[model samples]
Target: MTNIAELRKQINYHLYRYYALDDPIISDAEFDQLMQTLRDLEAQNPELITPDSPTQRVGAEPLESFDKVTHVVAMTSLANAFNDEDMRNWLGRIERRLPTWYPRDAVEFVVEPKIDGLAVAIVYEQGLLKQGATRGNGLVGENITANVRTIKSVPLRIPATPDGPPPPTRIEIRGEVYMPIKEFNRYNQQQLDLGERVFANPRNAAAGSLRQLDSRETASRPLAMFGYGVGYIEGAELQTHWDALEYLKAVGFPVNPDIIRTKNFDEVLEFIRQWMDKRDELGYDADGAVIKINDLTLQKYLGLVGNAPRWAIAYKFPAREATTKLLEIRCNVGRTGQVTPYAVLEAVNIGGVTVRQATLHNFEDLAKKDIRPGDTVLLKRAGDVIPQVVKPILEARAADSMPYQPPTHCPDCHEALSHFGEEVALFCINAACPAQLVRQLEYFVSRPALNIEGFGVKISEQVAQAGLIHDVADIYTLTKTQLLSLEGFAEKKADKILAMIDESKHQPFDRVLTGLGIRYVGSVVAAFIAHAFADIQALQQATQPELEQINGIGPRIAESIVDWFSRPANRTLVQKLRQAGVTLSSSKVEPTAPQTLANLTFVITGTLPTWGREEAAAFIQDHGGKVTGTVSKKTDYLVAGEAAGSKLEKAQTLNIPIIDEAGLKKLATE
Candidate 1:
């Protein structure tokens, strides 16, 4: 005989703590246990189920189509301001239109981040969330009440608290439904692991998640919201925009804490600058800052202009995304002989930088995106990160455009391209290929591989073109006289380059393994293989079964290892490295530790205080724990850090134990 009402109230309180306040007293597993108990009681007593109940958020059936919702007051967009000058011009227009009694300097503005998400309007009747709809046009939108109910931050029924006003007769709250960057990354990683099509960015992920026909699918996505303004309200006498925000917050609506009210335009500018610098530090993506008149009276006086309000302006930061025509698709052979596709764009400006080229990842990704040459594609660049093609604008694509076919031969050396088992990328197997030689040399001297300074791409290309270096092994045989023959090789520069190359001979065997750029052997795998084998000779002699016995080395990686070692050229290259006096084994070696967490699978999320994710995962693996990307029923524990997102939520829902950095350390010692 479970009290269903009490259980719903308790679950809702925990939801508010976890979602709205970012603090939870009990662990996720404990919360889920309580939820399960409530769910069981509801299942036994179906007559007691209500629309506002926590269990009623996700429906069993999928919707065929969304019903249209007509807004009482039109949801208009804001006019843009690219610079301070544009903002001043907008302010000037507002000042001129306002009544003469209103003071220019005294006009207050409510400034908030313009979240890069889908705009939605939620209607509340008697403090119960009645309807939710997208801003499809200005007037009519598709009803998404069933999906919106699944969002934990959105209150299903507003309850009166000590310092808050009672429920209003009717109210319309407008907000941006967004996916946080952390959650977006987790979701994308899961998609990649599952070999599914991943979303290009957080905005796309949120939009797709919210528009799902199945409410259960929507419930699975980590969607949150922050109320910005109102469409209409009844039985509420809000005098100013700030007051309206406060009232909305008081009535259990989530409003951004960063929202500020300032009369001085200088303060507004400062706010904009601060946010522009720290936008990435935020959990969610914000494209710009929205400035609106604080006074409801002044807003009415200013009125509407075209489709936007004259009293409000959106001061956008530099463009992070834009549309451009993909002129052509080209392939480049990497040091590892992997062929990658790239897009040549019709020079588009993104974030004040001209983006002429962007990576298509690989042929599989290129095909998955189906971006054909002559298509208008969405280009995105985040901060200093490399620009990439998000996807093609299908509606704007040429009618006669066909699917792109990958080249059968290497674009640079004309060697036949071939793919290994289960690999998505095509590889050029010619070790002596001129393009491969240059790329391989560049990789061998790279910071992560050999830590050689002054041996950049340009230098590597020059040395290769001069025939002074034919392979990675040839780099050690270069003479001072031969280097001086090159155009930019002065006495001091040549000596420095030689010294850096000399210093790299003492690098550990693991680095040498990584420097070789063997397929499926990255820094982590190299470390594992180095620890397992006594030296390079022992590793080369190891069989496929021996390689597969090591944890994390699957059948594919084992096959790659055996195949690489079996090659006559690769074996000769290893002998050349040894003859050059390079280190072939680890200096400090210890016996393997006890396998305390042998059967456990851990999923790590967020930022740990002293350990990075990779470092923490390494420690876990060393102590015999398996680290995975996604959280599931098989997950033993979730290693949570600051601002853990969807993984934490899913872990909690699945009743998996959640541990902090300290707890993980304790587990390692135990």
Candidate 2:
């Protein structure tokens, strides 16, 4: 029989060291090999797979719902310091308080970059990741274990030695959840293509993604995290925050190396200044620096007051702010016809980048902010959000400064602008505006859209300028030879573009709808519309009330659809697309037969051993069963997989049916 107890104990200790100590000495492959061995051993000796074993971290039980967990020690928000004087005052307070508590001659403070992201806690029992939760109100948070498991940096099981001592029985690590700039950019682009409103910054994106009701959706986005503090621990003792971070790294968690232990306040100040100048160079966004007392005992003595800890204080850099003169304001007609205003600024540094221009949203926003050329404006580049003018420096404004006025015609096609009855934006009605055509063509060939492989920004512009492609429909008319003649494109690349365009013709109707760049009609909504209306003509004729009946769609979405279809130019573009031979209707003329599952409803919990959650949901949906979000009396079945939670109990309470994958397969087949 496998020494399951021994393996569990050893793995638990290493996990504590890695996640809490950040002092991993072993390679990731070596750690994985050990875990695999333990898993294999447990497989052979089934009885040895205890609930606390590493092998049982994620198992066959499905969750009916997650139980709310309250924190023993509440997570607190930090106080902000906006300027140098604020920083000095904060340091003085700490220095004044330090002598009264400790006998040391000089106080040492550890300064680390303050990550601007969502705060979360991960709990492990005997070295296996058991639960993950958001920092909701500091006292209690929503459990998000499934989504946390998807983060690659978070270790699934703590490492163990063949004969090493057992790991800590319990431990909790706290960290910031954030998206890197590159990932944030890609995600926003995807959202924009799908017609969803873009996130203002990475912090907002991380928070929103983490709080998603569906863990599967949260896992789909590129989210990363770093452990910074220990929330709770047993079996091992840690003296300092830095030590805890080192132990965390030792097992397998990724810890920020930028955290430095300094003996003097001046050094801490220097580190803060250095990071401020190089903030953009870092992989993640840092709004400020956190300074903490090194001794854990001293920290406890200082205790908490309200939401902040007296032992720790955040020294925020002056917001990545700059003042610049707006030389000119111009409107750019977007592919969807919204006239967006942009300010040409006298170059200034904001968020470590030289910003020369910033978006003003729309003409309505310009009037709302009362922005104008020749006025000094405060600017900021918030995470991966666009550089924007935060406000005008009223005191800095010259006497001659005047409010900016929006243009009466489209800058690209010179078409007269017209406003919607209730909307703030003035839109250009021209379908063939050069700028609009170029933007649409670019969006069409983008990887997520039609994914025309070799078509790039320059090539798309050239094609439009040559009148070879006026709309997405015109891409089908281009031959490989004609594409090869374009500047900088080679024969091989041209062949790829043509092939991609050909492949795009077979794209599903939902994708086609999204590529149309309809206002307020994003990817999810488009899919919902396609599934409901079935055909282009049916969708075009859908009344506002009919469209509003769908679960996710609202009155605004219905109005946008009505407005899009009502336009003569938009209707012409649709005809052009139809002429290009793109499939304009759902191919599913007859719905798939309802497989004895028409009225059944299922709620899934935990990780399925054989198939992904999406695959399982697809199986349920295909057989005419509905996959509901939560467990309730209406649910006919609760599919329990590994790592099941409170959802399982709720099912039992309501007397709802529960089944495993094997049972589900049987039901589907029957």
Candidate 3:
């Protein structure tokens, strides 16, 4: 019998890591695989099924730091719909079980973003919060009252706003405690700066923060709530799930604004399809969306299938994380001659793409992860961002596999590789390295650089491999005859390339500086250097101390700038660009708006009406204000917008002045 007990034990152990510890060793897909195996076994051998089997529970047992409370209404899980066919099957099952008299129009469904977070049930006595607990094993849960009180969005009292109606005598509100994506990244960076261990994801951060032994520690973490549905209600009569959600929000729970309610099942599928592509924009990580029967009566009648509600199903998005065997490791040199490690995997599919290669980040990250060939590795792939090897599955490593030894020489040019002071990446530094030139040429003509159109990495590679261009400056020196000699270069294409290369000379000095492929001198930092130095000669002559005086230019960046200018070859390239008539100097432009925000600090969050987050931040900086990531007492104003999440709450709690996009414009122009 394949020892079904061992499978159960393994599932239970992983459940504890996922729920109680908030530090899962295996990926979610791996956990699901184990669970599915156990489920299949139990289905085949019904006599071997036990009540304590992981398949029979809602969640793991809560940590011992808090007291346990049993739920009146069990906090059950939902069956998952992974695809359109799976969802249709679920709908068919539900329709078959429902009363024949009920029309399709009468059945409405509510879809809520399934926040990747910790599920907790908050109990209220009259209008005040009485107790809060985790969804521990569905029936019993931990008493996390203190930590629950720390989350600003939880509403310590019902009807959190003044004009709302009186609350239910007793209500058990259920919501996911989550850290927003932006907040989680900022928090991780802050923790890293303080030499603390960073979390693997936002869900872990939220769960770990909530389970913190100290409530004060929990308070410092940027956490928020998104109420999905009520578990148990005493004094209210909610006929539908949509009405319940409305009542929960009306009585002051924070519900996600992007939820949809529809009578058509096609619309439900369409909603999930649309959200699958846009879940990143939600600010919080939502692995899927929860689809529930709107009618409370239908839910009650069709409830309970193992541990999940038959009336509800989770429309899971495509898996972004997967476990795959790492076959080999390769190195690629970037535009600045920085060599980085990447994994050549045994081809795993993540987010609907077959990822044969994944990033190892740098040699330092590769070393820290202890990744070796012939080991099973955890891989993560977000949209457009290249797939990355998160870590190696140490237990699955081959006994004879050795530690990865970085190459002593550049793979492309076969030249000795070296690293600069305090830098992680090994550098090629050979100006004529074929791979290095291709990347440099590509970056030189990018939108943030010289803004050259009709020139991309492919074209850069074609020109480089054909020996038509040696450096970025050589692009400006190329004639239509040389361009048309390359493959895929028609007369029109060749003319466009020549025209764009000529047009690139008109780009501001900052763009020219950025296009130089200098380490740490991105478009923004290049702008500061250009405005301060006015010309390439002045910048090259400037001292390290002078570069450091610029607001955004730090010691590391200054050192890189000084070192780049010190190189003889780099100076030669600068002269070549100057001879090509590329602008190497420009007069600074005056800001259209006055420095009304002088001496003030601002922090912008979420989606604004007229501007993106970075655009808003730049606007503030242009008007003489400092922009920071976190909300603190030092913040003069918080430029908040829709879906602002925890930062907005933190600013409000700190009594920092809050302003909208319009208000920010007013402040800048005042």
Q: What is the C-alpha RMSD of each candidate to the true structure, in Å?
A: 11.5, 9.8, 17.3
Candidate 1 on 232-268: residue-level lDDT in tens?
8898788999998888777667789999999998899
**Which has the higher TM-score value, candidate number 2 or candidate number 3?**
2
Best by TM-score: 2
Task: Give residue 329's lDDT in candidate 2 (0 to 100).
Answer: 89
Pairs of colliding residues, candidate 1: none
Model 2 TM-score, all chains together: 0.60
Candidate 1 Cα deviation (angstroms), residue 582 = 36
lDDT of 3 by residue, 558-614 (tens): 888899888887898999999998888653323565768766877777668999765
lDDT of 3 at 505: 92
Ten residues in sequence with the least summed lDDT for candidate 2 = 54-63
Best of the two (2, 3) by lDDT: 3
Off by over 4 Å in 1: 160-163, 321-378, 383-386, 390-403, 407-670
Q: How well does model 2 score by local distance difference test?
A: 0.75
lDDT of the candidates, in the order given: 0.82, 0.75, 0.79
